[model samples]
Target: MHPLVRWFHQLGSPPYFDRFAARWAPWCHGIGAVTMAVALWLALFRIPADYQQGDAFRILYVHVPMAWMSMAVYLGMAIYAAIALVWRIKLAEILAMACAPIGALYTAVTLATGSIWGKPMWGTWWDWDPRLTTELLLLFLYLGVIGLYAAIEDRRQAARAAGFLAVVGVVLLPIIKFSVTWWNSLHQGSTISLTGPSHMDASMQLPLWLMVIGTHVWFVGALLARARADNLRREAGKAWIAETA
Candidate 1:
């Protein structure tokens, strides 16, 4: 096996993660910052607004990516929860715990931007649309995990509870994914489709993809840094952790 594989396995042990984070966090920060800058330039200025929607369509850059990330992050949390539950890995639990708040923030951004765009396009800000409603519920699920984690004092106990919450939350995700298709809604159908045909042009499509890549990278940076901090706090008294510090 590769030395990096060995390093990753040791990461579940905490001390190695701290050392890894100490060396790599700065790089992650730097890259994410640069990526954000490039994404802003591409999304805000280089990419022209829609022909029909005009300035209103600009919201899609933020809205679409956040909506996608919110769901993607939740799915990730569920996977981490499963890993923690099955393997009894502290690192996985902490990673799942760290993912919830960020995921919630992304969900909020999705809803808020969707609302902002809706006012101009649909002539209304709020809707009982299945897609919109299901996404809102996703935000609530994120908050539930965060709150449940904080409610308990013991880290192990808290993680187990949060992990369980995340696992249960997984069932709601398919509902979010299919909500637009399954029910009537003021919201338009998906811009990008799995089978074929993205309802967007190259001018619009390029920046949106850039934003997606940038955010996924942001997710990695955030998850790793937060997971590293978590390991530090949990492994506070260990000889290796101390030596690593």
Candidate 2:
């Protein structure tokens, strides 16, 4: 078998995963912190103000990354949920459930920052724009998954039920992504594109990309930490738990 496949198989073991998470989570967190700090420094002091919005545009450095994370994390959660549902992988269930709160957090930040940014740009704190509305629905879906997981008495069953909801909610992602294009919305169109040149200047774009990369790495650390804790709780009284302790 391939080394990668073997490593993945080993990762499936609760004790092995616990050790792996413990060893790597801190490193990921440290890297995320350093990257975010550099990004913030560049965004605050080094980059030029927007020609139109001025310093207010700096919020995009935070807002855009969180907005991206909100959708990206949900997509990841849904994939983990699908795997858990089909394969009954306990680690997948833990990961899917762990992702809910983090995704919800990113969604909340996106909305809050968007509101702050919008007030100056659109002259309103909130609007039922297509992008905003679908994003709100996405938040609700995240909360619903979290609530459902907590409502059931049995942990595995709760995970499965919540995972099912997560899988069903995958439809929201595309709608959120294309909302501005599909409707006459106040929100702006995409500025950055992987396949083409970005609309923003290179200097302004650099920090935003740094923040995006930092946040994703931070997310992995957070996810692994949360999953490790949940795994320990679920495995209470097991031989490995005792051994680990």
Candidate 3:
């Protein structure tokens, strides 16, 4: 078997994943925390303020990462959901379920920080801009998945149901991604791009990139923590838990 295939097979084993998550969670969290602090320091103290937005632009350090994570997490969830539905992989199901609350939290953070930033610029707490509206819908979709899974009694059945919803809701992800470009909106265009030069100064962009990487690292720790807890609960009667404990 290919090395990558073997690794994935190992990952699907509950005991292996549980042990891996236990060992790696702290490292992920520690690195993420330290990186976030450095990013915050650079954003708040080192980087020059925007000429137009001034100090108000500092909020991007938080808001931009949260926004990016919100969509990235959902896309991840959808992929896991697809895997679970196709192959009935138990690990995939747990991962898909675990992603919902984390994604929702990012979505909430994005909304809150966006609102705070907007108040000074747009002179309002909220606006029904295309980007904002689609983002709001993304949050609702996350909540819907969480609620639907909880409302069902059987774990497997609930996972399937929620997985279906997650798969269907993927349509919204593209909408959220393109809303700014597809329509006129109060939101600005992308500051970073893969195919084009960034529109930001190198100093400003460095901290934002650090924050984005830190957010994703932190999310891995959170996801592992949640997946472990859920695995224990779902396997409360299993022998592996006793052996590991």
Candidate 4:
């Protein structure tokens, strides 16, 4: 087998995964922390206030990253769910289930920060804008998966059920992405673009990118840590757990 394939197969083992997560999770957390700290400092102190929104625009650094992660994590969870359902990969199931709480957290943060940013700009803390509404739906989907997973006594069965919900919830992602364009939204359109020129000045864009990168890295660490704990619980009383303990 190819080295990469071999490594992947080895990673499917609960014990091996436990060791791998333990070894890597801390590094991811540390890197994410340092990067986010620098990003926050630059966003808060170094970057000049927006000509239009003034200092209130600084919240975008926090809001945008979490908003991006909320969707990204959901997509990731759905993919993992599909893999687990098709192949019955226990690790994939664990990973899919593990993603729920983290995704929900990011989604909640997105909503909260968006509300905070909106209070000054839109003169309201809440709105029924298409973008905001769909994002709120995404949070509910996450909670549904988490709640469904916990409701069942059988871990594997619960994962499969919740995983199915996650898979089905993917339809909401694009709607959320395109809501501003598709509807007359109170929220602003996306300013940053991957392929095209961004609308914001380069100086302001720098910390936003840093925050995005940091949050993604931090999410991986959090996912692995959560999955590791779930893996241990599922594997309790097994020979590997005994030896590892």
Candidate 5:
């Protein structure tokens, strides 16, 4: 086999992954902390207010990143779930299950911050905008996965059932992402794109990028922490677990 495939196999080993998670979780957290703090400072203090939206626009620093992560995490969870179902990788199952609560948290944050921003910008606390409605549905999907997993008695069986739900829910992700384009909506078009010029000025853009990157780094740290706990619970009968304990 190729060296890359060998490396992947090695990384998939539970014990190896546990050690890797232990070693890197703290580093990711540390980096996430520093970046988020710097990003907040830049967003709140340095970036000028939008001439049109004024100070209300600063909320984008929080809302956009959380919204982006909500979708990204769901996609990631579905991929992990697929791997668990197809390859029967225990780590994939753990990771997929772990993703539920975190994704839900991001979804909740997105909704809350979006609402807060909306009241000022749109003069209403809520609107059934296409993007907002789909985002709310995304939250329900996350919660459904969590509820289904908790309702099952056996961990492995629960993961399988929840994985199926997660895979099915992947359909919601595209709907959430494309709602702005597919329908008339209060939500503005995306401000940043990798393939196109950003609508934001450089000052505002840098901090938003920093926050986005930091949010992802923080998410990995959170996932590793949750996955580690899951590893312990699932592997309680294994000798390596006792040794690590």
Candidate 6:
């Protein structure tokens, strides 16, 4: 194996991951928090009102970012699951477990805020659009992961099984992304993209970006903190606990 891959597998040990998570998690979360705060405050009061949606349009900022995160996090979960399955790494399993709730939260936020935005734009809160349907499915998928783990007494077996589901669920993500373009829907096409933002102006774009960063910060902080807590609980009788604690 390559040096980087070997390093990653070794780093999957609980103690090493816990220590590294301790350091990097705080830094990512802190920087992400600062970034989000600056972006949100500026967006809330400074940006000019939308000529169409007015102040209610502000919710779009939050909605879009969370929607993006909903998809991104599912992909992240898949990667973590793959790591656990291929490497048989214990920390990788826990980390995969850690990501589910965070991903679910983003999915929930996406649906709620999308509803708030929809009331004015579409005359209804929901219309069974592909994006909404797929996102709902995504949330169910997260719950399924959590449930699968919870139902099992054996941690490793549970992780492996749930990890398989996570990997398979990612196949649905692209269908959600292209659903707007592929089918007729009230939901708008991608505003933010690889080649600069498409529809959302910088004013709308700015706050949405901030919310994304904030969500990311929240994801990192919550996951690592949970991961650390899990490590402590699971390693209650291990030698490292006595040494570290």
Per lDDT, the best of the predicted structures is 4
**Residue 131 displacement in candidate 4 (angstroms):** 0.6
| After superposition, candidate 3 runs with Cα above 4 Å error | none
Q: List candidate 6 stretches off by more than 4 Å.
A: 1-10
Using TM-score as the measure, the top candidate is 4
- After superposition, which runs of candidate 2 have C-alpha atoms over 4 Å from their true positions? none
- Positional deviation of residue 11's Cα in model 5 after best superposition, in angstroms: 2.1
Candidates in order, TM-scores: namely 0.93, 0.98, 0.97, 0.99, 0.97, 0.90
lDDT of each: 0.85, 0.95, 0.94, 0.96, 0.93, 0.83
lDDT order, best first, reads: 4, 2, 3, 5, 1, 6
Per-residue C-alpha lDDT of model 6 across residues 140-243, encoded as one tens digit per residue: 99999989988888878988999999999998898998889898878887767868657767545667767777878877887887777776677788998788
**TM-score-best of 4 and 5:** 4
- Selected candidate, larger lDDT, 2 vs 4: 4
Where does model 5 exceed 4 Å of error? none
In model 3, residue pairs whose N, Cα or C atoms come closer than 3 Å (at least 3 residues apart or on different chains), thus clashing, are: none
Query: In model 6, which range of ten residues has the least summed lDDT?
Result: 196-205
CA-only RMSD, every prediction: 1.7, 0.8, 1.0, 0.6, 1.1, 2.2
Task: State model 5's lDDT.
Answer: 0.93
How accurate locally is residue 52 in candidate 4, as Cα lDDT from 0 to 100? 96
lDDT of 3 by residue, 50-113 (tens): 9999999999999999999999999999999999999999999999999999999999999999
- In the range 103-139, model 2's lDDT, one tens digit per residue, is 9999999999999999999999999999999999999
Model 2: per-residue Cα lDDT at residue 231: 95
Model 4, residue pairs in steric clash: none
Model 6 residue 235 CA deviation (Å) reads: 2.2
Q: Using TM-score, rank the candidates from best to worst.
A: 4, 2, 3, 5, 1, 6
Error of 5 at 56 (Å): 0.7
For model 3, the run of ten residues with the poorest summed lDDT: 198-207
**Model 1, position 88: C-alpha lDDT score:** 89
